[model samples]
Target: MSSLLPRLHALWTKETLALLRDRHGLAALFVMPVIFILVMTMALHDAFMPGASIDVAYAVVDLDNSPQSQALVRRLDKSGSFRRIAVGQDLDAARQGIRENQYALVLGLPAKFGERLLAPAGADGQPTEPLTLLVDPTLNPALQLAFRNQTAAALGTIRADELTRRAGKLFGLPVSPAAERDWPDEIVSIAVQNQRSIRPPSSVQQNVPAWLVFAMFFVVIPIASIFIIERQEGTLQRLRAIGLPFGHILAGKLLPFFVVNQLQAVLMVLVGMFIVPMLGGEALHMPAGRSLIHWWLVAASVSLAAVAFALLVASLTRTSQQAVVVGGVGNILMGAVGGIMVPKFMMPAAMQRLAEWSPMAWGLDGFHTVMLRQGGFDAILPDLLKLLTFAALSLTAAVWLNRSSQP
Candidate 1:
């Protein structure tokens, strides 16, 4: 056992130094994933929480020009729900804004909006039509629901105040505290807001971490190529000739790449947490509820899963060309099935079902739970077990296949 440890350590040093000497390869290995994390995180963050940003854009066309319409607009403006509001009498411009920016919502108040609130019961006590709220169809469903609900509440508040004020003016008295009783329970009136343009869901949190898992697994290509190179150079035979055990040799080779994968994982996490914000992008914040130890365990599982996948590809391929195809194209195929390329939530029913069993999908789910969701080790145990199982099976398969093919 003592000799085994020393031999493995020596082999690990050899593999690591060989990788480090190849500056261009190491640069590609580290740099590409970092670039992807920064770019994808930046591109997709706003979509995840549409209103999280201070600058939510929308327009209000107060065609009523009355105290009621003005009050509603002022309330919405103060709510900080929107950053920039284009306020004018121009319905055309409001429509244009909704069409131009998918994130933008438009509110239009009709000319007789004030009169409708005060009319009480016209024939029957029917509720007045809702306010005109134009929303982009492509907007996120959650954001759409939130925007609609918020608008409803704001408009409801303004309507009640307007009704009370109008009743006081009609009764020839200043508005009083008892004015709350003046709004008849029978009067069912809400503003008439139109619904318009919207865009697609850009679910950022799911995507960034999903692609990060993909990039980690994609180390398959380079690692597989290295494995094939060393084998072709008869390095494995020389080690065997020098009395190195096959298991220890394999362990030594993978240990360095395993560490490399962990480093890559950290690089991606650091980029997301610190560098992204410095570059004018929103940084991913760690959850207060999660312990750092649990988070590291999840990170380690991801690295092991990725390296195991690479080892399997490396062992199965006989040449560098085959390794590239197996690692590159094969990982992409796995990624597609795993919801790395597309969100599982957005996928079709069949695909979503299949993704439930995908190893990459499990890895991503683990990350999303701890990093974004309020998850700890307990929340992620099932996924961790699945990942560990996958790693064991994949490594076993690689070793078995290599042994079977040997002359």
Candidate 2:
């Protein structure tokens, strides 16, 4: 046992030294991922940040030119969320702005708008016609809904003030038009209920895990390339002839890389937890009262899958160039299909259904469940099972292929 311990220790030490000495390899394993994360985070910063307001251009066509119509436009502009474009004289001008995607909504005030409002109600004392809000149907649904609600509230307030002014005029009462207005005591109150009592994880929390999976997955090509290069140089056969068991050989090669990958994972988590807050992301929610066991399990499962995939690629490709080409192409294809490049929710239904086939998708889903959903081991069971199955299948195939390639 002591003799084998020295052999294992020597092999591990040698592998670690080789990894440290190869600056290019170390950079690929560590610095490359950080750079990728920074680029992606910067690109998506606006989308993930809270209160990232959009500039929604609104083209108003006020045919009435009445105080009521002008007041409504002023309210929308003063809100600072919607920018009022130059008033379009005709519907064609409004349509042109929408066609150019410069304006998301258009408000057309008819000539009769003020006349109708001042006129007496129907016999039943109800409004004869409702105010019109013309919105671009192609705008984001959430934005459309928000604009609709805002427009509705603004019009309602204006209508109330207009009615109150007319009422005061009728009685010759000394009342301020605003004071006489029957605006609701509470215009709008939002009550947010966090039923879980735990603040949901931010985009960084969800993205860190998903991006880490991608970072690790992409590194598989370079990792396998190292093995393929050693094979081409006849170093692998030399090591085997020196009496290193294939299992020990594999372990020695993978152990240091795995340790490096784990440290990268830790660094990513720390950065996401600390630095992301400065960029307007919220603190990552570490689920209450659980040890680091879950994190370790997740990392282990993902690492095993990554390493097994690398080994499988190395076994399949006879040349290092082929391994690099195949691995690079496969990584990109999988990344695209896996929702790493885009949010799954934005994809079409068929494409979303297809994402399930990519291991990257499964990895992202599992990570999201644990980090974002604050789910426990039970929630990640399916992911764990799928990864284990993939790893086992991949490792088995690699071993069989490697043995068959030998004399």
Error of 2 at 349 (Å): 2.5
Model 1 spans > 4 angstroms off: 1-10, 21-25, 54-56, 93-106, 117-153, 156-212, 231-244, 281-290, 333-354, 367-379
Clashing pairs in 2: none
TM-score for each predicted model, relative to the true structure: 0.72, 0.74
Q: What number of clashing residue pairs does each candidate have, in the order they appear?
A: 22, 0
lDDT of 1 by residue, 172-196 (tens): 8777532322223232223222242
| Candidate 2 segments whose C-alpha is farther than 4 A from its true place | 46-52, 56-63, 67-111, 115-201, 279-283
Top candidate by TM-score: 2
lDDT for model 1, please.
0.72
Task: Name the TM-score of candidate 2.
Answer: 0.74
Residue 161, candidate 2: C-alpha displacement in angstroms:
10
